[model samples]
Target: MWKCLERVLCLNCAFAFAIILARTGASPVIVNGALGYSVSLSPLTSVSQGIDEVVWRRLSPRMKLARCSQGSVQYFNTNYTNRITLHYRNFSLEIHDLRKEDAAEYEVITATGNTGNEHSELFQLKVYGLVSGAHITVQGIFGICNLTLICTVTSGDPTFTWWRNGEALVNDSTQHIRVLGNMLEVHHAAEVKYAVYKCEASNPISKATAEIKLRDVCKLDTSDPLPNSSICAEFQATRSSAATGSF
Candidate 1:
């Protein structure tokens, strides 16, 4: 048995200790899944001369999930059934329909029969629910779309992605668009006019999207002189922004 040096680590803090682990290199396994999503954990070497056994364990609960030897795999934990598949060709552990309880550090220990040597790999799995109330608001101009599109989600952790007409949005000054965290600054470009903007919030297991076409949501007439109209000032602002080539 290889002697174990005990240390506590969370995935978020794994990077600080990545260079210390030579067997797994300096890369931290960032496996995140939303609730009810699936994730896989694989050993560093898929094609090693391992003739003995492989063990998969969850460090938090000290639960042995699977054991494989001589190409035969066994599940010691009944909590996993169709949810796990060791036959995934890469000697990887696959867990399906993840639950929050499944979040923990996972370790893969392999023993070589001929050399009587054991090697280990460690990583953390974080599971969370999807973001609720995923929506965007337009603040600034109207027809020119030169406005700040702020995306708001109930959850603070899920990654946020912005899309326009099914295409992912990128922050390029040439394209007159900028993405700053959850806020998207849009300029009136050929691609920005009247296009639907989608904000997607997702975790490993859950994904939610909300889209809004500001043009459709706010009707403005540049010719409308009525100052009392809610959108009249927006139109005036759009005209002013048009000089900046935003229109």
Candidate 2:
């Protein structure tokens, strides 16, 4: 394992024995749900008051992941209050129904509940997007029509699901979408059907979604807004972790 070190000086200390602080290079520390991403510093300690706030802000000037303060968690500012899942136990933040706006570098701040003295670290998060198209590609012998829907999303290990008229397409044979190289193929598509097809792509730490509407021969692709329920779940799950800056 590769390692790096940082030192702190307490010149006026009363204790005879010196305290040593060694820091390794951003090493791999595991967090829940996020597969490969790791915390640079794991198992951080706080003074007697315990932890108070955990704020994950974009490294730059972009929107930040939800933050947990005191006893409550908030999302995307005020309008999204109580819409985030927080895991304060481990200081981890999870944002569900992620959006493109959520993409960017992030700073995680941890503070002592009583004194409010804080420490923070930064991380980078990238959001992925998808492309989709659909049309009446074939016509049956009688009046039947075969519609094909094609969807392509970025990033590896992306999961694809199909929806029609806001209903999840559960039948594998008729309304199934095939996943291939970040692309989804739907065979025997319905003609003159009006519905929405959504592709949600995510890694353990971050998530993004893309949607397309099927209407006649016209195809419209758009980004789905972050859902309130998903945001709430993300906040609650990560609140504890965020509060303490733990695994």
Candidate 3:
């Protein structure tokens, strides 16, 4: 009898869960959030009326974030104790000061009555960090005047772009310009037409650029058969500092 009773209870729970899933018919909305920023998760379905109680939860490794009922709010997660706000009217949630770990699937459940029926909405939050502290380094081969410019960043995953004289730099075999990932190589440096080179590092949230003068870094006298290593060394020491600015 006990086993039969257990099976009946399991079936009841599954039926209740199916109803909740049916109410949350739409797929989770994608929401991009930046670190140390705020993001709002609003339900597509209107909850202005017939909402007795509202609960917000993180889906995976399930944990309650906040709850609202009878015009009063309660927070459950200690980490987000003072950082989350719940809207009583529409049953929406606003999270502040987002962290990397906050990137996850969230669900808002609304209860209308004692009929055991609940309406739920899901949202997928992706948190990204702002790009910053970008710099460039220059290196040259001993015999040839070929030079490679490398852009490095102190934080954030970013895409790198190379520019010349405020224009986008394109790869051309004839011009000896090659862009490889974060490194830009200039073969036969003297033959290159542009003087000022810029490397821009960017992400979804922000971007930064670092500029370099060709004459400043490549101070070698190309006319001479053998370039002076001492002069190159001196230039390397003085121009080692990268020129950086935010955009």
Top model by TM-score, which number?
A: 3
Instruction: Order the candidates by TM-score, highest first.
Output: 3, 1, 2
State the local distance difference test value for candidate 3.
Answer: 0.73
For model 1, residues 1-247, the per-residue Cα lDDT tens digits are 2233223335535744543464465454767665666777767766456547888888788889888888889898877767877752567888888877888888887777886666678878877765566766667745444678777776535677887778888667346678776888876564423667777766544555677665532354545553432342221111000010001
lDDT of candidate 2 over 1-247, digit per residue (tens): 1222222233324222321111212432333222222222223543234777777655456566566776676667542244345565666665544455554555567777665456655555544432222211111121122334444433344454555556655445344444443344544344545445554444444445556553432222224342322221111001111111212
lDDT (CA) for every model shown? 0.65, 0.43, 0.73
Looking at model 1, which ten-residue stretch has the lowest summed lDDT?
Answer: 238-247
Candidate 2 error regions (>4 Å): 1-49, 62-65, 76-83, 113-117, 129-247
Better of 1 and 2 by lDDT: 1
Model 2 CA lDDT for position 74: 67
In order of appearance, the predictions have TM-scores of 0.51, 0.33, 0.68
**Clash pairs for candidate 1:** 33-204, 33-205, 34-204, 34-205
Scanning candidate 3 in windows of ten residues, the lowest lDDT window is 237-246
- The clash numbers for all candidates, in the given order, read 4, 33, 0
Give the number of the best model, judged by lDDT: 3
